[model samples]
Target chain A: MKKTINIPLGSQHISLLEPVRFKFECENEKIISVDSDVGFVHRGIERACTTKFKFDAIGYVVARVCGLCAITHSLSYTAAVEKLLGGEITKKAKYLRILLLELDRIHSHMLCLSHTCENAGFEAMFMRIMGDRELVMEIQELLTGNRVQFDYINIGGVNRDINSEVAKKIIENLYEVKQRVLGYMDEFTNNWSLSLKFKGIGALSLDDAYMFNAIGPLARASGLNIDVRNEIDYLPFNEVGFAMQTQSEGDINARNIVRLHEILNSILMCENVLSGLPEGAIFTKLKGKPNGEAIVRFEAPRGELMYYVKGNGSAMLERVRIKTPTFASIPVFSHIFVGENYADAPAILASFDPCLSCTAK
Target chain B: MFDLKKYRKKSPWILHYNAGSCNGCDIEILASLSPKYDLERFGVINTGNPKQSDIFLVTGPVTYRSRERLIELYTQMPEPKVVVAVGSCTCTGGVFRDMYNVEDGIDRYIPVDVYIAGCAVSPELIIDGVVKALDILEKKSKEMEKPLKLFKEAISENGVVNRRNVALKVGEVHEEN
Candidate 1:
């Protein structure tokens, strides 16, 4: 019975989490086609950036683009502006930035993992992960003053320096988090229902992953080795020797595995960066104004987030453009969800941790 | 008869719906579930499917485009439903009250059981509001047997004539009389 079943979720859907519209064309509980309509909550964020904001204030403005990936957005925006200014940040600042970014990864992955577990009917798993996840938030609050959006990274350097007092807590917190997270991984992987539901569903091959320019763990999970952290020299990530994990399955389980592996790697990177924390000036005084255009990339919680900024020697920026990971993931979503059942759709979409604010902004 | 306390204690699932607000409410709502607040101790969890959720945590002021969808989602939810308006945005439109696309609040479209107020609403307050809702849910479950009869008797005992006059006036105005 291949009859048409129209399922329109969002625009005000209870379970959507984000404010977006989705029209699903299902045939006997199997989603045949999916149409997503964004821009309902678009506040002209990019336009607001160029017209109403100055270059210095845009760091904070862009940071508000996505609450979850605010650190990534702010860092990318500041990096672009810093490049235009041609001022050099200290090695310590770079390491600190990378450390904060990895912390963000840990926070974001835990969020996604919790959400996915909830969607998969593993309420206990979700709650347990969220419990352990608070350690990362506490560590973030300890270091950056804010739990989610750390406004620490500014134009040339970081706002808050990591002192020995906070550093010890952060180190201890990371160890506790890693231990708790290992238990979570054991439950998530060993559970037959979770493994069966996630494995081989929403299978996206490496060719398609690369064709659609999938970056971060989403791309790496499908055997497409394209992590900006390893590939780019924007920061001193390579100095700590961060390893990228990949899987050939390219399914929902593969994505989960990639995120899990990445979170582990992120913890390691943070540990290494914190251990080798250099001593120098966290901030440098910029005498003149920025006069050129620059583009910068950073691996956000989702994937590679790219930012472009052009300053016209004035306090106001001439232009500011942001390409978030979710924006890139949109093209890949259609390809991955083509033949999957409707039940698997939410988990698959959630595996990518689609942040609509990040995409729209 | 089902044990109301046992069921209420076991199934306190919430499904978060963003009508149209800043992401402040969304992050705060998720924060309550995370370890800092430790909401799971109360057996409260967030589910992605409304079919499985007992409470609907509606955020943001309902927009013009979102009204139809809001009603649709409201109807989709099964009985014994509790809709909690979390944040000033959902309760009274917050700062987005003047926007052309926005309705005043989600209550204008669907019924709301409790209102959790704040510019964005903190996780601690959200937990308090949920606790209050659980109290309401507990009361409602006990009174479900004679809800209509009890309402009718109370209306008759407490000035039925005035209520009838008001209803007649509204009916006459709408040409339903």
Candidate 2:
């Protein structure tokens, strides 16, 4: 007899924020094998993009794919459309785009950090971080008018421009958030449950990370220095103070530290964008429908988010394919669950920050 | 004796199920429970178990595969419970109305008492929606007690009135007499 009992984790579980199911074959407390289903949140957005909506409107449609990384979805689609149409947006628009993108990343990472703490059974830390995350949400709402689904990026350029008062407010909030993140850095490094308990659990070796083709913080945590922000020159991430944060442990602790450091780096990038914003018109009014195929990659809060858009010079696009980071990370998630205690499953899953909505969409 | 009504109003545990909406509404729900919004001040806790929960806070337009689990959780919830549909997609399928894999809205599967509509419902709106759910929950509890009250009335009338009088009132008993 195998002497293994199967435990299903989700589809409607409290530990999960989205609908993802994980079936773990456990022998006593140790998990022997893991099976996961990631399609519960699929709403057929990709097919709708090609058949129902036009190329111009797909930017807004794709933003609904996942509210956490809405800005990245719209940005990648807009960039691909711009590529297909062969148009150049003004530098000011690009700066505004980066500002919003970085703001989105800061909040998403904070949410993930809070969730990890919650799974660790540190309820107070979860509450404290969640309360502090409101600072980033405030600035995001101040800049884009909406907290979650920004829908700020469009094909030609960004829809809104930043004024001095708004910039001052954003800068103030970012400064406050930076201070709070520093405090969290101390807590994450020194705390027993968050730091020590997470050190060696659910670890992925560097060789396994490479073999699994891990992206985003998951790969970066395992000493793989691959970041979409560093690879793509379309957006001026290098001009800003964007640095790749990496760690060697590749466990829950390293992932948390990488995310915290990334939050700090993202805040610096937002400040740089505000200070060095170029003077130009925000929108260029690119004319004509997209007639070519284009692929654009962006660094979402989770990892690399790529969009494939094909247009036939008609009102509707022929195809709108999305490659979400969470969808790509399912392999790494399944691989990491084996040989770990079943009790640590939720905390480890939270550390990966699997965005199921993005994966299914 | 345990007063289910009084305690149900004071502390209504929430069971959140993501039927398949984007994660915007789900995070807002969490934020509302956190310190700033402080929905927990009203004694609402998000629990994983369905049996102990009073409010079913469901987000998302029903996806193809998730509809079964959505109903399973709904049926597992005890009687006199309230269902709050958060986000526009969960209410009327919002942007994903005509999507192939989705079944439009959650109302097609589960009965919704409160519908909070926003692409991504804000924390303030989520708080408002939950407050409204508390009222509906209280009302449903009252209704659940109605049948017992009627049955008690019939037994009491059997002693107070004659057989003929009780028989005459039998027709009226079917009504809310």
Candidate 3:
């Protein structure tokens, strides 16, 4: 007997919350070949940033492109623009950014982790994880005055500064959150149901992950050492005691565990940064216009987020190019989706936390 | 009576969809699942596929580009489905209401059974909205009425059995009462 199975999904497929198309050739419900097309919501964010939006205002808009990964966009853009202007954010501000950025990491990982639950048929566990994620979002609102598009970081420094009282509250919250989050790890880590669902699922062999040049968690999960925070060695961040989490298998379960473990590390890093935060001017006014090309990389919640900025000594940036982790991981997404059950497609995709808005921009 | 109280105890899985908007609601929606508010105790889950989902939690105002696709996905979902508009953007188009690109709200394109209000909604409200959606779903599952039909006629108006926009919208409108 001979047969053919075609599963055509749109940039607007049910599994994909955002716009991205994938057509899978399946054999007995297992995906055999896969293809995709993006750009459904490509708003020309870079074009608007370089041409229309003011340099300072662009940060807010960049962050808005994808709420899930906004911090990566804003921070990477700031790093690139700051480099072009030969500006360095105060050590205090750098530390603060890390705090906000890591808070972002905590919330994002919680989301991906919880979604993993839903994907694996552990609906109860998904709800449990989501319940715990609220503290992080509440902290974000309290600190930045906004939840998603924080608009905290500017060209030089952050818009908001944390006071000792707020800092204390954050610390208390982090400690409590740490205990609470850790409490759930056994369910996430040891539960046989989740382990069965995720273990060995969506295996991106080290060679395949590297061949596709995957970055961030996708790469890290594959046992690749490529965290941009460590790569560029940003101040305080580099000094702060932290380590990257990775897994050798590069399967879905490994990705989940790596993220779950990394969240603990992220919490400690935030606590340390806040505890020893130096008091100083939150921002330094930049004097001259941006005049040259510069590249900046920041470790976003996803992975290594890179921004390229070209300036012409004017208020307007000449060109802005963002190489988001999701964009870098497209080849990897396609590569891993093959041979997986059609049902597992959504789980594998969500495992990467593919932010289409970030990629489209 | 298929006790709604019992049904409420077992909240169904939800699938999140972003038609288009600023991501304020999207993030907060995700936050409801995190450690603090923890909607999981209520049994609400975010599913990636429409097949397994009992409710559709959407954020952002629908855009022209996303209108058809959203409807198509709605059609593909198995019945006994509830649509929850979970943000100001999805509810009323929010700040993007003025944009030429937006459809104003997901309700403009699809039937929204429940609304969770927020500039980006708070996690509390997200939980509340999910509970409301479950009630609606419970009441719905007990009824034998066909789904609401939003569109009067398919654009082509061909002599075909189908007059719906997409799979989800197939019988999702009420004939003029």
Candidate 4:
């Protein structure tokens, strides 16, 4: 008889922020097989996007897909619509969009780092990261007029423009955030207990990462060169100083390190955007309906978020398919869970930062 | 013997479940527990075990697959528990109202004591809702602790009180004139 027992985690658990269930087949301590159910948070957002809301309103509706990456969702959708309508937004609008997107990434990465610490039993570090995360949130609220779900991006361009006072405030806050991130970098690299919990634990190799087509920080951590920011030209990422951060270990520690470096890079990009902002109007009135199918991909906090919008020269869209990052990385997530200890499951899950809402939506 | 009820009222451990809403309210709830909002100051802790919790904080609009688990968690909790529905979608299905897979709100299946409304409710509102749920939890605990009246009233034809009615009010402490 096979002496394996099954342990189920989540759908509703302390470690997970959303609803996702995993059944792990374990022999004593090591997990040998894994199965996951990620449909608990699926609310038919795709179906509703076509039937319930019009094209203009769908920008905000899709933002509800995942609050942590709301800006990315709306930005991709708006970019797709602009592509369809043949509208050319101003350079200033493009820069502002990148600014908000990078700021969102900073706060989101902080949330993931803090959550990883909390799951690994480092309560103090968890509190410290979370407390510092508020600084990014403060800047976000200042720029977008909302903390979590900012419907700042519109069809032609962005909704809000930054004034000099707000710009000054952003630069000051980013400086403070940079200092804090440097301290965290030192701690994450040096702390003995954190290293023990993260290093060589729940690791995925470079081959496995490539085979699974892993994207975002998960791919970057495994030493795979895949970042939508580098590939896409919808946003001027290169001009505003976007760099791809990667690591070789591909473990929880490597993932954290990748996220921290990305945070620093994003902060640099935000500073660059504020200093080199072009002079133009934020919003442009595009006078036409989107009449073709267009696919737009942008980097969400987790990975590459793709939006496929089909329009038939009308107000109501034909189809709005959102391929969220978490949905694509499920295979990679399950692959990493196998051969890991059942007790380290929560920490591993937190490290992946699985957004079931994005997966299910 | 230690007073479990008093301890529960003072330091209510919370069980958070995401049925189907966007993650806005979920993150806000996490933010409230963090240092800035610091809901832990109120003796509230987010726990994984349903049985060990007194206050249940649920986010999402209650999707099809999550309905069973939502009820399972609600039933597994001990008596005198309070359920707080966080977010506009969880309250009344906000933007996802007509979505095919959603069941509108959690109240459709489970009873809700407090509802925090917002596209994604802010941390301040979530803290208020949890504090409000604490009061409701204390009331329910008191209601559970009261002694049974059990006395039989007159069965006069004018206004007779039946056994069924008396059984319904068995443990309730009615106010006397």
Candidate 5:
């Protein structure tokens, strides 16, 4: 006869950055079932977007959805509004937008990687990655005024422009970040203890990935070819050398490798955007209230982010719906936890890099 | 024997909880603990268990669903604790003020000793707030260590001995004033 035991993680755990609760049913050491509560951080942001903030200000408001993916949120909302208003932004602004978007991806992915290391009990690795992450953060601060919530993208285009001095600094920083990432890649692939914790743990197969409709690194690690960056033409991702990174193992290590490779790819794209930036104005003025409905999709650091905006010829929006990546990946997250050991639960959860704020919002 | 109070003052473990706001403040807090900010230099460690933590660092505006957990964590923490609210939203419900699901701020559920103000408070500000919290924690610890005294004359007309009414009378030896 077998007896089942239940263990609860989070709502507030050392491993989790946000409020998310997971109830795991274990038979001995193997998890039999997983139940997750992701609504703890929900502050009714969707309702507030329509009711509290106006169409012009909603861009910045939506940035509050998730700080790690603030640029993607604001970018998607602005793109939707621009679609409704029928505005064409400048090419330079487009390049700058891509620059910030990729920069955001690099830092966000670094944070996730460091967090995974910490969860796997590699504290030194966590500190190293986090310390190096400040290089990207410094470049972001130089580009935009603030560090985390840049509020860089506005209605028609971008809020800030990059000069030669900032451009040089960005390139230098990217070089340092690239070298650091290569070192991390070596450690992740060859380190025995890290492999013991990460290798073959929390594996999500390609079939299950597709069946659960996984997106971003979670899906790509499982060998599924789905990325909003490749699918969407709103940004010149292909022009700036955006390449999809994937891994076949689909375990914690595969996810880390995918993130590391994506960080490299994002750095290359940022370098490309900075080097061959088009000569034009960063911001353009659009002349009227947005009318009608528009849907926009962009790839955030974690996964795909979608924004649906419905507006009338008034100050207020009729409706605004935000579909965040982690929100969609929760089902898959639950599914992956089924067969994993109870001790590996935190590492597995960190590997997914679930953003509860985005989910609850 | 090592003095636990002195050790606690030197190294105060922290318990971080996200009540409801965007993850901006939470990430900033995490960044501060990392090497760049090096919050650990001040002997600060982020602990998961509430009972072992000395300083409670809370982010985000308290939401309806999280209010109970927020209070639960606060209650589980041992006495002589300090609660630091990190972020504009957590300080006073900055942007999420009038939202239906939000409870304005964490202070609605528990007392906030230090308030760091910013849409997303930077790591520098977080370090400063924690430093200030250490002082407050030390003071609270000292206050908790003081013994209470009973005074019969401090009883009110309702036959209840009010501590606030007695106030300095118990803690102090009065000369004939």
Candidate 6:
């Protein structure tokens, strides 16, 4: 008789946001081993990027990889292309790009936190967080035409320019969002179900996070100082009051707390960008096609998003490769699942904020 | 006795499946369910089981691996169901079209009654789509509930007793009603 039993969670589970299958081998209550399949959403995007679309259009094409961090996808691809083309965009465009990126981060983090709450069976809190997330979405719409997939970033610079009236509205919304976030801060810390229950439920220590090469909030929660925003010089992240938020616990609760703090930080950064309002044109026409390969990295809502664009002095590029955050951190995700109870699987998985579309794409 | 078909439209549970989409439209669907959009006011609940669901909300282009599962889910669902294809990718394989692994659209696998067009469908558009789906769902239920009527008496031919006229299909309209 087999003592260990295998249980599968999603190609389509209620708790999961996307279609990624995870098979857990359990003994009694503890998960002994884990096998994950993140290819359910794979549309062969990498192949299409190289073969079908041109280098310029690939920016918009790549943004469709994951909707949560659409800005980061297009921004990363654009940054890579910009490097190859060797053109400098205006200060205003850079500021606008960061503005959208931070706003995307705020909402994406909110979505993750709400999903985590939902997985923990706190449906009311899920509704609450999701409702508040619309504030950020409102700002996103003000900046770009669309709400979710903001095709804001282009190869040279951003697509839209901000006016004073729109900027005023965005600032007002951000302030309201900030106050609400502060309220959430109090609630998340004081609440029993949201933070306390998540404590020690799915823990990954600092050493393990470093060993497994974890990135983004997952690693940051484990007390690791690895943020692509801090490293990259392409964007002026440091100048806009961007600070790294970290927690030593490396559990679901800590990850939640880290995200909350990061949302506040992102709100601050967006505010700073809007207030500063650099004077320059939003778009620049940089001539000459990308001749050589360029690699660029950006901190997406989930984690490190890397884009490699190789062009051969033509409209169509030789290759376009993307390494999404969830794909890079799968090792850490699988490792953390073992030695945890099967019942807490959904909560643990939600805490990681696994974006399967990004991974499979 | 309660009429199930009558009360069914009052609270229609939705089963949302990601056939192979980017998370954009999926999040928008979730957003519509949230308090801001308040899709639940229509008595719509996002459910996991296919059997209990009335509306099948599918996002993303149907990938090769997800095709079988899509068909299986479609078959598993009970009758009087509405399939709403959300986003352009699910409708006509928008951005992911002509990709190696992706199918043209979900309609290739399962029939879509309502198609919501957007790169990532907004909460407003999703609401509109769901409302359209409700109308279709009600129409389907009425069609399903129609009684079977015999046009003529049964006839025995060559020792095979079969009522050819009695085989008037349910919901089929007669010319001289």
Backbone Cα, N, C clashes tallied per candidate: 0, 1, 25, 1, 0, 0
Give me the candidate number with maximum TM-score.
2
Q: State how far residue B23 of model 4 sits from its true place (Å).
A: 0.8
Error of 2 at B124 (Å): 0.8
TM-score of each: 0.81, 0.96, 0.79, 0.95, 0.94, 0.95
**Candidate 1 per-residue C-alpha lDDT over A139-227 given as tens digits, one digit per residue, 9 for 90 to 100:** 88889876755678888889988899899998999999888877766766677988987878888888898899887777888899887
Question: Candidate 3's interface RMSD, please?
Answer: 3.6
User: Candidate 5 on B81-172: residue-level lDDT in tens?
Assistant: 99999999988888989899888888777888998999878999999999999999989988888765544346566876565655445336
lDDT per residue (tens digit) for residues A245-314 in model 5: 8899999999999999999999999989888898988889998998998999988888988889898899
Q: Over all chains combined, what TM-score does candidate 4 have?
A: 0.95
Candidate 2 per-residue lDDT over residues B1-177, each given as its tens digit: 998767889999999989888899999989999999999999999899999999999998998899888889989888988999999998898999999999888889778899999988999999999999999888888877875223323344546743343343445565644
Model 1 Cα lDDT, one tens digit per residue, B73-149:
77887767788998876898765555556688888878899998875476788999999888877766666643332
**Model 2's lDDT to the true fold?**
0.90
lDDT of 6 at B87: 95
lDDT of 3 at A82: 80
Q: What are the DockQ scores of the candidates, in order?
A: 0.25, 0.84, 0.23, 0.75, 0.71, 0.78
Please give, for every candidate in the order listed, the TM-score of chain B alone compared with the true chain B.
0.77, 0.87, 0.74, 0.85, 0.84, 0.86
TM-score of chain A of 6: 0.98
DockQ of 1: 0.25
Deviating ranges (above 4 Å) for candidate 6: B151-177
Off by over 4 Å in 4: B151-177
| Model 3 stretches with alpha carbons more than 4 Å out | A9-16, B1-16, B30-58, B61-64, B71-119, B124-177
Q: Between candidates 2 and 6, which one is better according to DockQ?
A: 2
lDDT tens digits by residue: candidate 6, B43-135: 999999999999999999999888888899999999989999999999999999999999989998788899999988999999999999999
Determine which window of 10 residues in candidate 5 chain A has minimal summed lDDT.
A10-19
